[model samples]
Target: MAKYVAPAISLSPFTCPACGAYAQQIWAHAIYVQPHANTNYDVAPLRRCKCASCQAYSFWSKETEAQIFPRAVASPMPHPDLPENCAAVYLEARNVVGDSSKAAAALLRLCVQHLLVHLGGKGKNLDDDIAKLVKEGLAVQVKDALDICRVVGNNAVHPGEINLDDDPAMAGQLFELINFIVRETIERQKRLAEMVDRLPQGARDAIAKRDAKALNGLA
Candidate 1:
């Protein structure tokens, strides 16, 4: 059996798996001392933490067992060279529509979604960003030029009355969607190459000179 103890003091805090993003910046407290013989309690009182980027609360002990472990560290922002991982999710959503014609919009959705997923550069809220792209970006322009076919991507998964084959508006939306994605992808890719200057000096010179060898080993 375990013995009962009296109220105790808490001390300075470390990064909370729970909080970092508040405007004021507070830490979720970590307990350094505990009752000597208590076996029933798995964790201490809840403390608030904020997401450093979005300023969301970081709840303590959401993963109780996970609290005791280590996770591999990776860069906060994924390299610009690897935006394809971002594109993959959009492609996945495209497949959900089950039409080749949908590819263009699917690609666009992927771009918007990609930007959203990486909104913070830490690559957080990307899903939220995708949501905004659909709701704010695509849906906003529906009556004007964007059309609403792309809404099927969002609607099909939810309480929407639209279907892919039955709706031409959806088709038009898909067209606009594709154009958006392709333009953004090309721009970002170009921007990344410029930023990194990743190509060899000869490769850069070749591209500058319209050299066919810039096609990568194409003789």
Candidate 2:
């Protein structure tokens, strides 16, 4: 028998960012459980939910219930702290490197830039890494984006054998690596944003203003 258990409790209630209303229907009360019936067919936990605002009813099985469905958190609206200009800069640099696929390279660049900005006051000089990241605009860091100008990006462009067309798979692999970097970096920025929000308004304004010393918490 598959031993499965529902979460200890329903997730915390959150106001929907979209509709700006309490998402009461998200509190899942019914969880499907397998009966001690024939072991042949797997009995999964199930859930039924009704949206009070939308009047929509949905059914879910045990397997799907475990997945963080009806995500607990709502995405925040765009804030002023982010560097809006960097998006265009990322795109222009990617164009230099022939980033033609779905061409999300720029967004990946933005993701890394924000990650580094969040880490600005912290970590080693990392300025060389930052310079390279800003210049190259690629996710060279397997662990962190600072590894980019530190290694991959410039090295990949080294003048040895220009066989980019011969093996297009390399491009795909690079894109995939960048995609991972972008995904992780974006998540980090979200958490950091909340942290920044908790600080006093003066501190928040300093960081939002991109006051390097202020962001570093020096002042």
Candidate 3:
């Protein structure tokens, strides 16, 4: 799936959030009037656009410049290498971010929890699972990223600790973190292993012997 890229201006070409296609947008003002004392007063300025590729429409307030239709905020595409289940939930969270950031955050937290299990973490408490992975040598940056999602997600579920609605941007960050974790923990390792597998058998055997001797020496 194509990653979402917000348009610099409403009329500018951009990746369609609905269709994930980069295309030009045709823009027009949507006028609405209210009758008061026999005089019609225009309401807030509204703008609408149609994607050239998908022909899908998006509406936004000219004053606020916020998307009103398809309430979901633009979210980065899920990493191409994410596991199927994790990717599904990630997209689910993305679809609802504008409607309820808290709900989206909660869903992302679940995605992280599932991802940990897929990464061989014990399917237990989220906090414990994260700690276990950190103990097992997860990169410091990845551990910090995981904790950000874990903490925000907990706050979203329990409420009162942090107001997600007040800070939708933080929820957006979680999506990026999810992809980052996958790239670091899963994609990077897979690429390295594939590269190692491509080495000549004789070289691979020699490397294995070298590691074995190092381990024996450590013993």
Number of backbone collisions per candidate, in order?
A: 16, 3, 0
Over 4 Å off in model 1, which ranges?
1-82, 90-112, 119-150, 168-179, 185-219
TM-score between model 2 and native: 0.29
Q: Best candidate, lDDT-wise?
A: 3
lDDT of each: 0.41, 0.43, 0.84
lDDT of 2 by residue, 156-197 (tens): 444334244454333334433443454455546677878888
Looking at model 2, report the run of 10 residues with the lowest lDDT sum. Answer: 1-10
Candidate 3, residues 1-219, lDDT tens digits: the string is: 354577644657787778767788998776555555555444447777889998998888887888878663568778878889988999999988878899899999999989999887875788899888878888999999999999999999996678887898899899999999988989899999999999999999999999999999999
State the lDDT of candidate 1 residue by residue for 73-95, as single tens digits: 11111122325765554444434
Which structure is stronger by lDDT: 1 or 2? 2
lDDT for 104 (candidate 1): 38
**Regions of candidate 3 where Cα sits further than 4 Å from its true position:** 1-4, 8-14, 19-72, 213-219
Best first by lDDT, ranked: 3, 2, 1
TM-score of 1: 0.29
Clash count in backbone of candidate 2: 3
